[model samples]
Target: MSDSEPRMIEILRILSQQEKPIGSKLIADELNEKGFNLGERAVRYHMQILDEKGYTERKGYSGRVITELGRDKLEKGLIYDQVDFIYSKFEEMIYLTDFNYITQRGNVVVNTSTIYNEESINILKSIIESGLSVSPYVNINEDKSKGKIEVTTLCGTTIDGILLNEGIPAQPQYGGLLRIEDYKPIRFEELISYKKTSLTPLDAFSSPNRTSVMDVVTSGDGLIPANFRLIPGIGREKTIEIIKKLDKIGIGGIIAISDEGKDILGITVPKGMVGISIVGGITPFRAIQEQGQEIDIKIAEEIRDFNTLSPITSTIKYGLKPVEHTPQPKISFLLSKSWNLIQQVNFDIEKRKGDIISNVSYLKKEDLDKTLGIMEETYNSNPKYINPYYKIVNHPSDDNMVGIATICSLSIDGLLINNGIMSNPKYGGLLELTEPPLFIELISYNGSTVDPHKIFIAKNMTSISGNFGPNKILASFKEIPYIAREYAVDLLDTLDKIGFSIYKIGKPREVTYNAKAENYNFGVVAGSGLNSIAAVRERGVDIHVKAIEQLMPFENMDRL
Candidate 1:
């Protein structure tokens, strides 16, 4: 219900209430009357942008009228505003009230201001017992002072937009604070690789039976699918079924990033929705659909074929009025407050990893289950029932064997960490993945001994190279072995000779180098001895035998 963007809504609303085309001056005046204080010039500027954007129209110099796109924008704004209002009221109630005692799952505890009348308490009790969520609450302490009350609720009244499933609603909402007790996290070094095959919309429609606009755009190779469901006329029941099926296959919950280009939720899977079916050629029910324009399958397919950035491209080609930008909004059952729970859960998970060794192996399901059950019983018996965290891992023996590692952990932020679970006492405990930079370091060392700090030093070298150049330009730099400094210079010099471009070089002592012509640029730092060379490699510096030979001129000579 939050208007992530609000100004656009305000502009649309002003145009909606007017019958005839109104000039920007009048709109500005109306907004000023409503406390916006926008000058006519600024309003006119926004009006022109909106008109060009297709949200409004300039009719014969009369001014601007709300286009169908503008109306759609306004309608969505109202819905978000209403939802925000409800959530704000709920927050306000929690902030102001205090409860003397609060009970959850029959565990009663005292709080600051639990003085609500018996009837009010009972009303809440009924709602909770009926498997429905309640607004935020307050707790009063024994001293009649307020106590801490943490209230949470899921964002929906239904499961997959259905009030009932099999004649019963999904009560005891599944979207509450992720119970850390529910899942187990298995750790496997193999799962750490990012080569796993995952499903996408293209995969969904590439089969012989499916006909998606994505198929048309990429000649059945499948273009990036749009999240909007513009197909039209999809029945509620069918949508519900689709949602459940998608959930089972783990294809749902992907969110497109916001305009700010930050992924706050961390789930970065992209999704393309199979939009509403355009059956019977009736007007589409979606807000983005034009109010009176009849749409057939062809028009719907054309619209679906366009990507998010070019939403109106096909429509313009067809001489249709542009629709509002209608990318699918992120829909989540969990509320924002779950973020706090996620932080706590992640902390706990890190803490639990302290002494437990991770195992990576393919074991018979029964044997693996027995070992994990024993481990859980020994380590996590206090929490009688917890959720299992599925950690998918690649098998060491078989690249084709992908195993799910099940361990216990909390899933507050709607993501599951892959952990490998199979442990064999005979196979010498479990395998765990090292830190990301450490893994990169291992590769650079080429199975040779390298200090972990080499990776950090290498990354730091890259950072320094970005702003600082060779030693002459820097006023001061750390002093390291002279050989280490020479190694960096020789590496840069050799790279330039052997098809690599060297753009900059730092002083001989604290050697810093930047490469430009490679597929990717790399930086080198030369302060520490072997560690410095190792660090540069970890930081992505590719070296050749010629560079190594030049850097270590005495390598072929025997030591006295």
Candidate 2:
């Protein structure tokens, strides 16, 4: 590939991300941000070449847009020159990992795989329990529309990252098929050097027909994906210490570490270096694939906060339970229900003299016992969900009824309004569990009739139980004037002390965790008041939720 071709490919990539045509100057600026030194003139020259090659088309003063042909070329072209791509990418990810074994609070690399059926989840659980993967912790995401579940596991490359942080340099040598006997790694049957291929070697070799990971699980003899790495002999003891520390924290994948100039699983180590053999993180997905489950796998994709991951055993114990399918309500019925809700809310607002209302939701008298148990279980499983300032209260109207009051997220808007700061509710979204969590799915307030958080809960799209940090939860995004920065910060601190979950507050005119603010405005992400209720729903309890139902005095609520 020519130097110009790479630049042209990048230009096409930039154009692909835009909905409208972008001029050469903007493209040049973006390229510079990506560490490319291309100027506007050079970008214009590349655009001209791209136009000649039918890859891009000029859009009348708006600049150039990538054509269908360009997208196809970008997807299919320039493979031969990428032989060292995987090696470089692996190295980059290793260096990016900043997970500290002590605090367990930094980022670690992860591999994501998708399975279409619920039965496949059991296979994954078994693999995690059997210690065939990198770590006991995993992240799960559910897509009800597509009928698929995405599972994220710690990548073996994270070992390199941990070692790198400890002042040790580790080199990835090969990804291969390791033979296992009596559940012990014995040898590498086949190897693909990182320097020899553009594709990830483990990904290349993860075929249902080639690996019998499930058989190994049941019979203790089969071939599974593994990798080889090398580190200086001097760091061997330190590496062992790190491994033990990781084990204490429920993370492991290093199968064996060899001494100086020693061979591991028949792979010879270089002089002054020691060999390390690690089980592939994708082994569980490989097992699923061997069981005739269709899966899409991406190897060592990106770094995620270690705190966001939870022990796989926790998932097996509290993971999503299969629920019986119920017939969908007719559109007319839904519309009628929505209309009734709107009228009820209006009536309640009038009674409260336009004050923001906090909804009081009720649990069925019969379900009170089971539902409360689920809530307690959730709080025990992850202490982050514990809110000592909040608790269930007796129903106002009926002696036998039970009620729970959740502060409306809209109350934040009201608070800002009282302070002379205008606030606009923007979206209700599912925020991904990351260090600085971002919204993975969103429903705009302007486009929806029902509360988006309610919709997400009803659709069973939340995974709050498996891992507290990495699971998606209901959150709302609101925009406030940038000038209210100091005031808003003070208000948020007050809200926190009063028990509101404030996710983040953004800088002026910038996107906050994937939610964009309007000009001269900034964004704020607050936890949906219904998160605890959602947790109950996740545990298979059916509860009726009335959002922003009625206003109640804060002093009237009880503490848990």
Candidate of highest TM-score: 2
Worst 10 residues of 1 by lDDT: 423-432
Clashes of each: 59, 0
Instruction: State how far residue 223 of model 1 sits from its true place (Å).
Output: 48
lDDT for each candidate structure: 0.27, 0.72
- TM-score for each predicted model, relative to the true structure: 0.21, 0.52
Residue runs of model 2 more than 4 Å from their true location after superposition: 10-36, 51-71, 314-560
Which pairs, if any, clash in model 2? none
Q: What's every prediction's RMSD, in angstroms?
A: 26.9, 23.1
Per-residue alpha-carbon lDDT of model 2 for 128-217, expressed as tens digits?
777777887888899999898988999999989999999999999878787777776667776656763444767657643668888787
Once superposed on the true structure, which residue ranges of model 1 sit more than 4 Å away at CA?
Answer: 1-5, 77-560
Cand. 2 Cα-lDDT: 0.72
Tens-place lDDT per residue, model 1, 1-560, is 12213555677877887788888788888877655778888787777777777888889879889999878655433332322333232223323222211111111111111222333333323332221121122221222243322211212121212213223222110110100111110110010001111111111122222222212222322111112121112233455554455334211221111222221211112233122210111011110011221211111111110011111011111111122223323333121322233233221232222211111223334333443443233223211111122233445565544433322111211111122111100000000112101111111111111111222332242222122211111000111233344544553355334212223344432212210111122223212112212222333444210000011111121110
Error of 1 at 218 (Å): 58
